[model samples]
Target: MRILSGMRPTGKLHIGHLVGALENWVRLQEEGNECFYFVADWHALTTHYDDVSRLKEYTRDLVRGFLACGIDPEKSVVFVQSGVKEHAELALLFSMIVSVSRLERIPTYKEIKKELNYKDLSTAGFLIYPVLQAADILIYKAEGVPVGEDQVYHIELTREIARRFNHLYAEVFPEPDAILSRVPKLPGTDGRKMSKSYGNIINLEISEIELERTILRMMTDPARVRRTDPGNPENCPVWRYHQAFDISEEESKWVWEGCTTAKIGCVDCKRLLLKNMKKKLIPIWENFSRIDEDPRYVDDVILEGTKRAREVARQTMEEVRKAMNLMF
Candidate 1:
């Protein structure tokens, strides 16, 4: 099966990115599926158009993170979204098919505008990002897209665009389905959704000393004033980290019992989580360190992947042109 997914190149990835997307992507590639993972640089511009300075650096770092997390370039095609012109071409065609009213009606559109505190999000690019997303999926005819539930509406919109194109022109693209990741939302140290914009994220490239400090500083049950006070693990972010990192059912239960019975202090609980987390993180740090030193290795991967992706994209565009009678 051909699977398509991507992440925006806004900043260095964090633990939330690891648990939410990278882990699932690695699993899919290991399963022998044809995976196309790209750096969504164009998508980043939709919201971050004001800043172009860090875009290149972020794109490179994102690719490095993919390599560090075991997304093999041999098994998966990893490219930049804007590397091939077909994406924009198809996006332009799709923009004509999707109605502006429909784009405005998307739940996240208004939410994003408000979240960013934009007095007006009336930009043509911002509104039609979903169309570009649909083009990204359909251009490859991806059978599945790995995403969180927050992106279900975008996938639905992709399906709608595919349906409209096939009905109007030819059956050129498949309506991809959303392959939901079962991973829970990895919260920040502040117990909110881990995001760079929030300034609460623990970046993947953090030093061991920083990691220890970050975990120790993580939000716990505010109601628990003393080590003797019983706490609800459900309300604690440390408990959430344990759920994702600690694979041992017995140890997990131990954490629950210890926290609830006031048998262990929050410091002890964080130490346990830190131990398990380091066991996994040490290898990623090692890999990223090696990859970071070798810039040409990342460049080679992007170039090769772009070559492979363009071959498929060009063919799809040919068919699209033939169907729409655009070729003179």
Candidate 2:
């Protein structure tokens, strides 16, 4: 399958990013699928346009994170979104075909605006980002887009756009399907959705001491005010982490029994989780350290991937122009 997915270059990737997206991406590539993963730098501008200073730094950091998390450049095409000018061109073309009302109806549009009320998200770019996302998928003629549940709607929009384009012009793009991620969303230490804006993420680059402190401080069942009080693991955010971090069935049952019976305190539960999490994250951090030390290696990977992506994008644009009678 020709699979495509991307992440915004907003900030350093956290454990949420790993469990939610990167791990799934690595699995797809390893499964022998054709994957095109890019850093959505242009998409980042939709929200963070005010601060262009750290954009480059964030983009590089994102790429480094991808490399560190076992997203082998050899197996997948890894590029920055802005590196391909075709994305912008195709987006402009797609914008005309898509309706303003349709874009507004997207659930995330309203939700994100409410979430980021502090920022002025009234820009046209912010509203029509789904169109650009469609261009991102269709440009590569991706058959499947590996996305979380929240992003499934965007893929649906992409399919709508694809059908519209094909109906109006000629069949120049594939109506891509959403390959829903198997991993559930990972929450932050504060028990809210894991997000950079929330300031609750456990970044991949976090130190061991910081990781320990963060895990220990994670929110547990609000009802369990005292150590003696029995806790509900279902309500505890730490328990959610256990579910995500490959905790064994036996260990999970033990934790559940202990929590419900007040046999284990939140601190001990956190400590146990911390030990298990470190075993998985430490290797990824080691990989990140090695890649971070060599900036040129990361740059080369981006340059090569961008070139390859552009080759495919340019061909798609040619077919699109021919289909739309714009070749003249």
Candidate 3:
């Protein structure tokens, strides 16, 4: 089955990105499925259009991160969203099929408005992002889209658009289903959602010294002021990291019991979590080093992927033109 997904080229990825999407992408490829992963440079504009001078640089960094995280270019079609013009064409055609009232109804639209706190989010491009996303999926006629629960609504919208297009003209697309990933929400050192915007993320390519320092400084249970005071592991953000990274239940059990009974201090608990976490990231760290050593290799990989992707995209667009009677 053909699967498609993308991430905005915002900045360097953190642990949240690893568990949330990259790992899932690698698993799908290893399972012998066709995967199309791209740097969503165009999507980044829906919000960050004000400053794009660094956009190209960020896009390159995003691809490097993708490669470092084990997204084999040989097994997956990886490219930049803006590299293929068909995405824009399909998105424009899809815009006519979807209603303004419908776009306004999407829950995320309101959320974005609030998040940005911009008095006027009336930009046509921003409003139609869901339509653009639909183009990203249907242009490939993708069978499945791996996403978190927050994105299920967009998948529903995509299915509706596909159904509308097929009903109006021809069966040119397969309605893609949302494959919800089992991604744990990793918190930052500040005890907030691990986000670059928050300045508390532990980057994927961070040096060992920085990684250790960040883990050591991470927020723990605030109520347990003294080492002797019994702590609540449930309230500690560090405990969350332990649960997400520690593979052995026995180790997790040890951390839980030790923390709850005052047998272990916050520093000790963090040291254990850091130990388990470092082993998981060793390969990614090595890959990051390799990518830095040879930058041109990353460029070659994206170019090759774009070449392969364009071939399929062109075929799909031909069918799309015929379905809409635009063959002339």
Candidate 4:
């Protein structure tokens, strides 16, 4: 299947971000899917509008993270969204087709407004992001999108936009489907969503010691204050992570039973979790450090990706202009 997905290159990506999305993207590519993964720098502008000095830095780091995490550059078309000018032009055209009220009703827009508390800076860019995303996906005429559970609404809207466009103009675009990725729910140290703003994330760049320290401070069953106190793995946020990071099946079964029966202390559980986490990340961390040290090699890759992406985007825009009768 032809799949399109993007990650916002705004900050250091955390474990939650990886298990939630990127890992799945890599797996899909490995399974012989045509995947288009881009650094969604334009999407970052919706929130971080004033502070864009880090765009280049963040984009660079995100690309490094992708490579580090086994997102093979050969299997996937990784490009920068802003590098393709057609994304902007196509987004503008898509905005005309979609209604303002529809964008307002989106759950994500409301959530971001509350999260950022951006009473005044809730600009049109923030509201129309999903449309831009639709433009990004439809530009390639993606057969499907790899997205988190939160993004299903936006994809549903994208499907609607495709249907409307096909019915009104011509069937030039395919009605893209959402390939729901069942990603593990990785929580923060503070038991909130693992985000940079929350300041509770374990970034991929974190060292072995730092990773262990972060996991050690994790909150488990709040009621289980003592080692002897029986805990509920179902209620323990840290236990949720054990299911995610540890060896996935039988060996993990040992940790699960131990946690619920008070046979294992929180520290022991975290230690077990940390060992598994480190083992998984060591190679990825090595890959990132290699790219981090050599900036030129990564830059060359981005430039090549940008050039290839532009060619495809330009051809799609030609078809778009003709369909809209704007190809004069």
Which model, 1 or 3, shows the larger lDDT? 1
TM-score of each: 0.97, 0.97, 0.95, 0.96
lDDT of 1 by residue, 1-328 (tens): 9999999999889888888888889999999999999999999999889889999999988998999999999999999998989999999999988888999999989888988885456789999999999999999999999998789899999999999999999999988999876574778888887777788998888999999988898889986899899999999988888877754888888889998999989999999999999988999999988987876999899999999999999999999999999964
Q: 1-328 in candidate 3: lDDT tens per residue?
A: 9999999987777888887788888988899999999998999998888889889999988999899999999899999999999999999999999999999999999987987785466789899999999999999999999886778999999999999999999999999999866663677888886666689888887888999999998889988899998888888888777767754888888888888898989898888888888988998888888888985988998899988888899999999999898965
lDDT of 2: 0.91
Clashes found in each candidate (C-alpha, N, C closer than 3 A) = 0, 0, 0, 0
Clashes of 1: 0
Error of 3 at 88 (Å): 0.7
Q: Which ten residues in a row have the lowest lDDT in candidate 3?
A: 180-189
Worst lDDT 10-window in candidate 2: 179-188
On residues 257-303, what C-alpha lDDT tens digit does candidate 4 reach at each position?
Answer: 88778887889878878878888899888888787787587777788
lDDT (C-alpha, whole model) for all candidates: 0.90, 0.91, 0.88, 0.84
In candidate 4, the residue pairs with backbone N, CA or C atoms under 3 Å apart (3 or more residues apart, or in different chains) clash, namely none
